[model samples]
Target: MTYEVLARKWRPGNFQDLVGQEHVVRALVNALDSDRIHHAFLFTGTRGVGKTTIARILSKALNCEQGVSSKPCGTCSACTEIDEGRFLDLIEVDAASRTKVDDTRELLDNVQYAPSRGRYKVYLIDEVHMLSGHSFNALLKTLEEPPPHVKFLLATTDPQKLPVTVLSRCLQFSLKRLSREQISGQLKTILESEKIKSDAGSIDAIARAADGSMRDGLSLLDQAISFGAGELLVNDVTDMLGTIDPQGVDNMLDALQDQNADTLMAAVASLVQIGGDYSQIIDALLLRLHEIALAQTDKKLVSDSAGNMDKLLKFADEMPAADVQLYYQIALHGKRDLPLAPDPRTGLEMMALRLLTFQPVAESKPVTNQSVPKTEPAAVSNKQPASTSTSQQPAPAVTASAVTNTASEASPAAAIAPETSKNITQNITMDSPWTDIVNALQISPLVKQLCSNAAMQKDSTFDVSLVLDQSHGQLLNKDRELELKKAMESLWGKTIKLKIELGKPSNDTPAATKKKELDSKQHAAETAINKDENIQALQESFGATIKPGSVRSRV
Candidate 1:
């Protein structure tokens, strides 16, 4: 006898053998047990997900000589013939091949006739969505009102293509894709039954490669067994599938956490030399990062990481969650654009470099200067200072480098406060308070227009008082004053009292305001330098657009 492939060899013969479709099996079994079968049944799902298999089983249940039972006895003639694909009463048609109106009419023409061998004549049409418009119209009437002895079972991956008229006549059942664990378990069972030796890791690799399709998983297993000749191993499966090993991914992550670019590059080179996919490496790294993030939130979800869970959790604790999320996004985009790059290695390196370059800087060390007493330290005599005369004299002089280092270690904020106050004094002109308040209000368009022509009332206690013109003052109602106050406080980081007084218009008008704006713009442009670190980075790296009206704070 010819050797059968694993897929066909492990085909499910009954509902009990079907995996990962409990809902579908339960409904069909209940219908069969209760003798409440529908005339037309529609099974829809992607390929290798038991759509057609369920149809075959249902056909057997309907026509089995043991009666319409959920568990049809395979010893019965009807079940045996159906299983062997020679049942006279069950007609399995491929709508993809015969998708014409004439073909549909010819098939439906015999629908009115009684069953030739069993209680029901089942028509199992695979890929029914392939039927043309005219063919669908031709079968609609027959599907809606088939003879008592006839049943229709239509299966399609794309059910949306089927007309509503055809869909309304049938009872639809959608089969779900099997999960990874379910697929792995089923493969293990099949391999055991076939007496094939394989490790769990190899089975898992095949399951992931299959992507939730049982037949695909079995096909992958068949290839793995043949490749192994007898024993299946994880390394062999990885080599066959061109998948990177979990250990390599773990090592790459370790390199990243250590910020050891040399180690990262070496690991990547090894992966490339071994014919591993660079994009898959990035994808696996992203998966590991996600696992690490979850592990940080809950320890139970980190069970699948072998012995690396503790290390991953440690990395997670050290790194901020935002950094992990950003790297994950970068890795995902790298995977998407990997094929477009000149070489996969180049793409992978670019992604790794991007991640390393953006890692957030660590927080600054705390200032540790010992505070002197408010009253100042007590003075000692110069010639025979208390106890210093008997002690060995200090070194002749301190080096300039030592003095500079001591001063450099001092807190810059404390050292710079006096200098900052002097600069603030010089810049505070007679009209500085008014101008600053106006500029702060300019942050919002509405407030800017309302206070355009307002005049400033100079007072020592009140930072800057605004007297709005009649029309504009009316716009700055009580609610608007509160809004302006909030915006000013946010900008200044302190409260500046503003008393809004309605009065006659000042000489400063909107036309004068326009002229001042142009002068201010020119002054800003002349003072602006391209050496600003943020602007330079934006221009050189990302080519950011700097709009004219955008505000910049004085550093």
Candidate 2:
């Protein structure tokens, strides 16, 4: 006896035998039972995802000798011949090979005739999209109005190429790709029945590599069994698939989180020994980072099926969320730049090291007894960075008098004078406490714009009067205003109604404040550099000019 491939050998004999396509199966089963089947049926999906198989099963169900019913008796001659690929009435055509007008016409020439043996004459055409325009034109009429005994079963990976005329005439059943768990469960069952000894980890690796195709999973399983000398092992499967081990990904992430350059490089060396695909390693690392980031918000959402939940939860607790987000972005950019490296290993190494450089400094939790100084604006800014620790101190209540004449006077405390209603831009006074609150609000970008650019006029009983530049009228909407209001409510711990008004803003919007802050820092740094004796001496002796825009404050 000749050996058969697992995909062909274990083909689904009926709807019950199929996996991960309950949706298509249920519709087909109902159609078959109700005897309300359409003349033309189309199956669409990717390769190895049961487009052809479902067509074949539906063909058998329609032609079963037991009668015209959904539940086909496999022992009957019609079912046996269909299974054996010798059913006379069941005409199977590979449209990829027979896509010309003549071929299509020739196939449909006999459509008007009745089925020879089975109750229905089933024309099972695979890769129907390969048919040319002329072929589709030729198929349109017969497919639309075929004999009562004739059923058209079309399958294709590319349905977009098919003519609208042909598509409109058919009932399309889309098949979905199988999940990793579904594929793995099927693999476990197959292995148990085949008497193949295997561990769950090896099966998992195979299922993942299958890329959501049951046939592909089975094919890989066959190759894995052969490679393992009839025994499925994780190490052998990993080598066969060239997939980096999950543990290696964790190790690299561990090294990155710890900022341990030596451990990171060491992990790379170990991967090099295994001849791992660096791109795949990068992808695995990206997956780990995503899981860690998700874990920070909801620990229960992190998956432990691969047995790494505890590690991820621990990393989430230890590594700053900011760092996790930064790592994810860098990893995405690194994949794009991976091919530019002299070698993948060196590229991966540089990316790993760059992650260490960008790791966020874990914020120190604020102490409860720490007093917020009322006099110093610098003190408030220092106490709160863009991202702070879990332990937060309630923001000090700000009074209107806290700001200097420059910050508020830039934007007058009084209602915008009628003269300022035009395009006149006023410079707000400095030292306003509003900018600090805006920065600390931690709202989304849209709401941030509304808050940042608006100045809060002192309102009674925790209410805020917001003034936005009239030019930004398009950005203001009821939804955005509500979201902005909610953010303020959360921050101040009081229900505050926002009174929105359009005028020339006399106060510094968050955008203006940020620009002012940057300009001030840049000027101070330049002045300091110019004042340095060493810099001046070097310039005097070497006739060197400080490079334009080179002096930037660390702030």
lDDT of 1 by residue, 64-168 (tens): 787888998877888889888999989999999998889888988888888887999899999999999988987888876778888899999999999999988
The parts of candidate 2 lying over 4 Å away from their true place are: 294-320, 362-555
- Which run of 10 residues does model 2 get worst, by summed lDDT? 363-372
TM-score of 1: 0.62
Deviating ranges (above 4 Å) for candidate 1: 294-320, 336-342, 361-555
The ten-residue window of minimal lDDT in model 1 covers: 363-372
Query: Which lDDT tens digits does candidate 2 get at residues 1-555?
Result: 886888888898899999888999999999989989998999998888898888888888888877777678888999989989999999999998986899889888988888887888899999999988888887888876677888889999899998888889999988888887788888988899889999766887888889889999999999998999999987788899998777777788877655455677777778767878888888878877887878877776764444355676888876666667767876776687788777787677666655654423322111111122443445665777757532333333342243332233223221122112132122322233666566555354556666667776765644667788787777788998888778667766777767887777787886676667658766865675555444444345434455333333534
In angstroms, the error of model 1 at 92 is: 0.6
Cα deviation of 488 in candidate 1 (Å)? 60
lDDT agreement of model 1 with the native: 0.70
lDDT of each: 0.70, 0.73
